[model samples]
Target: MKNWFVALGGVLGYFALIFLYTLGAYLLVRSPPWFRYLFGFSSLSIFFGLLARTFHWASVAHIVLAESILIGGGTLFSLFWAFFSKKRPDPGGGAQRSPEERPGKSDSPATFLPAEGGDEEADLPVSRVREEIGTLLDAGLSVLVYGPTGSGKTSGVLMECLRERQAGDAERSILLISCSDGMEDYDLLNRPVPASPQEKARTLRAMAREHPDVRIGSLSRLFGDWDRAEGPLRSAFRRAAGGERLTIVFDELNRSSVSALNLILKVMDPVLGHYELFDFTTGERLSCPLDRLVFCATCNMGEGYGQTRELDWSLLDRFPGVVFMDYDARLEKQMLMDLGVPPDLAGRMVHVALALREAHRTGNLAAPLSTRHLKNWGRLVADGADPENIAPCLWVNRLVSHDRLGFPDKDQVHGIREVLGRTFRGGRKS
Candidate 1:
C-alpha cells in the first residue's frame, strides 16, 4: 500500500510540474519584451549559481549574479516608467455624418477630425484614402489596398471601421488576419485548440447522448483532448452568413504563401455563395455561406519589400476595388509640423525622404526613407536631438547593409549621408 501511494504521488507531481512549465512557456512567449528579458536574466542567474556550486567558483558567481540583478532590474523599471510616463494624445472629435453618407450596415465613412494648424480638410491624402475605402465598401465589393510599407494603407481601412464603431455600430465585428509566408491552409480554416471547461462539458454531454450505454463519468476523463476551433476566415464567414456584419482584414496579404492564398481564393470569390471545408470531427464536408462579409486586405508589393511574391492575377481578380497608395510628402510634412517640429526642419526632412526615394528608384539604394522614418526623425529633432548626429542611426543604417569589413555599405551609406548632410545644413546650428 505504501509503495503504491508513493508511486501515485510521484506521477501526480511529475504531471503537475509539466503542466506548470507548459503554462509558463505559453505565457512567456506572448509576454512583452522587458518581461521576457527579466525571465531570461533570472533563468541565467539560477543556471550560473548551479554551475558555480558544482565547480566552487564563488567570487565569479557573486559578481555575475550582482551585475545581472542590477542590469535586469534597472531595465524592467525603466521600461515600466517610460510606458506609464508617456502622454497619449487625445482622440479629438470626429465630423458627424448622416445615415445617407454611411457605406454599409457596419462600415461608415471615416470622419476627419480637426487638427491644430489647419482644419480637417488639410489632411487630404488620409481623407481621400478613407473615402475611397468607404466607396468600395458601399459597392458591396472586397477591397485590396497595395502600397509601400508605412504608407497608411492598413490604417485607412481601420479608420473607416473605427468610425463605424464610434457611430454606434455595436454589432460590427472586425476580424484581423495577419498573413505570413509560413501560414498554412489549416491556419486559415480551423485547428485543434485546448478545450475550455464549458466546451468539454458540452462535448461530454453530446458523447453521453450518442452512447447511452456508457457512463458519463467514464467519458468525462477522455474529454481532456483538444477541441477544434474555426480560424478567423471561416469564423468570419460563418458570422457574416448568420447576419452579422463582418469586416475581415488580411494584413500583409502579399506575404502569404501560395498554398494559403490558393485555399483563400475559393472563399474569396464573390459569385460563389458557399465554400467547403473538411470537418474531421464529423467526417463530412461543411459548406459555409458568404453573406454581408466585407473582405479587405493590405498588400506591400514592388521593390524593397522582401519575402513577398507578386500576386497572381487569379487572386487579384477576386478584389474588384484595388487602390494604389504611396507616400504623400505634403501630408507627411504637415503631420511633422503638427508634432511640434519647426516648419523649416519638417520641410528638410521631407526633402531627405524624396532624395532617398529617388536613389531607390535609380537602384542606388536598396530601400527608400519612408514617411514613418521622417516622422521619427522629426520627433527626435523636436526633442532636441541633433538631426545630423542621429541621421546615421535613424535612416542611413536602415538603408544599407554591412559589408565584408563589418561596416555599412560604403557606396549606399555614403550617398544617404550626403543627402542628410546637404538637407540638414545650418539647420542643426541651434
Candidate 2:
C-alpha cells in the first residue's frame, strides 16, 4: 500500500513539474510563433517518449529525464527559429495590400486610399447643402459653412457653383483661395503684384506703363485718397459695385492668421456694403467699396487638426447664413457601398464611426470620428483587409487624440479597443 502511494505521488509530481516548466518557458518567451514551435516539438517528443514508457520498455525516471531535456532543447530551437521568423500580424496596424493587390481596381467606381486626403471631392453625390446655398446667398448675407474636415463644406460650395457654371451660368466666376496663416493681401487678392511695397508700386506702375491707355494711379490716389475715392483694398467690393458678380471662396478660414482674417472682416460688412481697407504703402484708409458681394467661408472646428483662431463676434455677425455640416452615417455607408465596399463590412465601419462619434458626445475623445475615416476603413475592407486588423490602423491611429487633449496614451488605446471590441465582435450595438 505504501509503495503504491509513493509511486502515485511520484507520477503526479513529475507531470506537475513538466507542466510548470513548459508554462514558465512560454511565459518567458511570450512570442506567439516561438511558443507554437516550442510546444509543438515538445509535445511530440513527450508523446513518443511516454509511448515507450507505457510499453514498459523505458522507466518513468528515464522518461521524465528525457522529456525534460527534449522540452528544454525544443525551447532553444524555437527561440532560434523565432528570431528569424517574420513578425506576427498586428490586427490594428499595417498596410497589408498594395494598390494593385487591392480588389475591385479593374471594375470599381472608386479609386482612393483614405486617411491621406480628399475622397474625390467628398463624393459629391452625398452632399446636402447645394440647393439651399443660392437661397442663403441671395438673402444678402455672407455664408459660413462650419464642420469637421472632409464633411465637404468647401467642395459643397464649389461643386454647386461648378454645376451652375457648366449649365451656362457663365456671367459669374467662382474663385477659390485656400486660407492659411500669414496670408498676405497679394495672395487673397490674387493681384499681379509683389508683397514688398516698393515691388508692389513698381509692378503696378510697370503694368500701367505697358498699357499706355492705363493710368498708374498715385499713392495719394489709392490712399486717404480713400476719403476722395476708393482704394485698392476694396477690390472685391469694387468688382461688385461695378456690377460684375463674383463668388469668392474663403476655404478653411480658421486656418488663417488673425491679420488675414481681419482683412476679410474689413470687406465683409454686408450692411455697410463695403469695408475700409488701409493703403498697403501708407497704412491709412485706402478705399471702401460699399457694394455687398457674395462671400462664402468654410470653417473647421480646428480644435485638434489644424491651426485655429477664434473669430471676433463682430466678424461672425456678418454671416447670418450659418450651416453646420454633420456627417451622415447612412450616407457614408451608402458611399462605401457604392464604392464597392461589401455591405457587411461597410455596415460595420459605419457602426464603428457612429460609435466613435457617440463616444465623442460623452467627451471621451477630443475629436469626433470623421466620415473620411469611415470611408478609409471601407476602402480597406473592399481591398480584403479584415476589419479587426484594419480598425486599429484606420480608426484609432486616425484619431486626433494627444496628451494635451487630456486622453493619455493608455486611456486612448483602451478606449479605442473597448469601442472596437464591442462593436466588431463583442455583440454590443453602437
Every model's Cα RMSD, please?
21.1, 18.6
Give one digit per residue, the lDDT tens place, for model 1 in 1-430: 9999999999999899679757767899788676676656665665667687778878765867776786678677858855774344322334433223323211111111112243223323343666676777766578888887886667634455445653666676678899988887777767678888888888899999999999988898766668777777767665665677766788999898887788777667645576454534345454545545667789888756779988899989988889887787777877789888887677667666766776666656667787778888888988999887888877777777675677775456645655555446523221
The global C-alpha lDDT for each of the candidates, from Candidate 1 onward, is 0.68, 0.62
TM-score of structure candidate 1: 0.59
lDDT of 2 at 37: 65
Model 2, span 294-363: residue lDDT tens: 6778887655555777778887887778877777555677788987886655665666665566566555
For candidate 1, the C-alpha RMSD (Å) to the true structure equals 21.1
What is model 2's C-alpha RMSD? 18.6
Lowest lDDT block of 10, candidate 2? 105-114
Best by TM-score: 1
